[model samples]
Each structure stands twice: as C-alpha cells, then as structure tokens.
Target: MVAKLRPYRRPAIILAITAIGAAAIFLGRPAIAEAAAVDGETEFVLNTFAFLIWGALVMWMCAGFTMLESGSVRTKNASMICLKNIGIYSIAGLAYFVIGYNLMYVDVVGDFIGSFNLL
Candidate 1:
C-alpha cells in the first residue's frame, strides 16, 4: 500500500510547496495600510467587510477567467494556456504587491503611476 501511494504523494507535495511559496511571496511584501483615521465604528466595520467581500469576488473572478479562457481556446492548447495564465497572475501579483500597489496608492507623483518606493 505504501509503495502504491508513493506515486500520488509527489503531486500533493508539489502542490503544498507551491502554495507555501505563493503565500510567502505575497505576505512578505509591504502592505499599504489605510492612512486616514477611522472616524466611527461604522466606517471601520464597513471597510473591513467590504474587503472581505472583495476577496470573495476576486476569487470568483479567477474561476471565471479560467473557464472563459479554457472555453475560448483550442482544446490542444488549453492546458498550456491555463498554466501560462496562472504563471502570469502569480508574477503580476508579486509585482503589484511589491511595487504596483504602492505606486498607485502612496505618494502620488501625478495622475499617472505613483513614484516607486522600494520599502
């Protein structure tokens, strides 16, 4: 039984490692905290709840993106394309977390992209 299960375990381990690495990359970046003071309890609660909702919505979007792209593309290329999209998303997430988010929110230079702060 152990010998039979060994083949299946490698994929699971790889998935676990990928998830850990992605989480580490995301959490290691500097996050932009709300700078403005919360005037009331209502605002605080609303903001927190809004973000929670946004997280769900974004996850839904990822599913939608996968389905839409997979459905639209040729059958032969679907897996390859989906993997590409996943990789692109991971890279974009890391890039945005590290630089893009800060550039957009903090210390705006003008209407365009904000200045780079390598914090």
Candidate 2:
C-alpha cells in the first residue's frame, strides 16, 4: 500500500501547497479606507488623460489614412487629398461636440430605468 501511494505523494503535496497559498492571499490583500480613496479631482485628471490618449490614437489613424491616400494618388492631387481629410475631420469634430453630444442621453432607457445594460 505504501508503495502504491508513493507516486501520488508529490501530487498531493503540490496541491496542498497551492491550497495554502490561496488561503494566505486574503491575509495580504490590499485595503483602502474610504477617506483615503481617490478624490474627484484625481478622477477628473485621470479621465482627461485617458481622453487625450484616445484622441491621439484617433489622430494617428487619420494620419495613416492620409498617408495611404497620398501615396496612391498623383503628386498634384496629394495636397488636395490631405486638405479633404482635414476638412472632413474638422467638420465632424465640430458637429459631434456642438450637437451630437446633446442627443445621446435623450429619452434613453436601460440604465435610466434601473434595467439591464445593453450593447
């Protein structure tokens, strides 16, 4: 019987060690007091930085599209293509900020009605 159990000893010990570690995790878990939690100003700064980084990524995509179009077209038309992209982006940015934003939260359900979230 001991010989038969010999092969299983290593597996059992490994499982025991992992179980011990999992139990110990709660002891070392990080805790923060409500008073020490992040404030509104800190959250605002973080949100602004996140928006800036996202806007930068979008600008890179716009640059890539312009480059692709410029590389494919004739030399004379390259400037026109660049101008067209700039114009479109400018108009879209203006419209989104000035008008599109106000329409987003109008008469919406789901979260507003304490219901399930949707895609």
- Please give, for residues 35-97, the per-residue lDDT of candidate 2 as tens digits: 367888898788778977998999999999999999999999999999999999999888866
Per-prediction backbone clash count = 0, 0
Model 2 regions more than 4 Å off: 1-37, 100-119
Best-fitting candidate, scored by TM-score: 2
lDDT, model 1, position 67? 80
Put down candidate 1 lDDT per residue, 1-119, tens digits, no spaces: 89989999989999999999999998887764544555677786887689779968986798789889899989998998789888977897799789876775576767376766666
List per-prediction Cα lDDT, in the order shown.
0.81, 0.79
TM-scores of the models, in the order given: 0.46, 0.50
What value does the lDDT take at residue 1 in candidate 2?
91
Error of 1 at 80 (Å): 1.2
Best by lDDT: 1
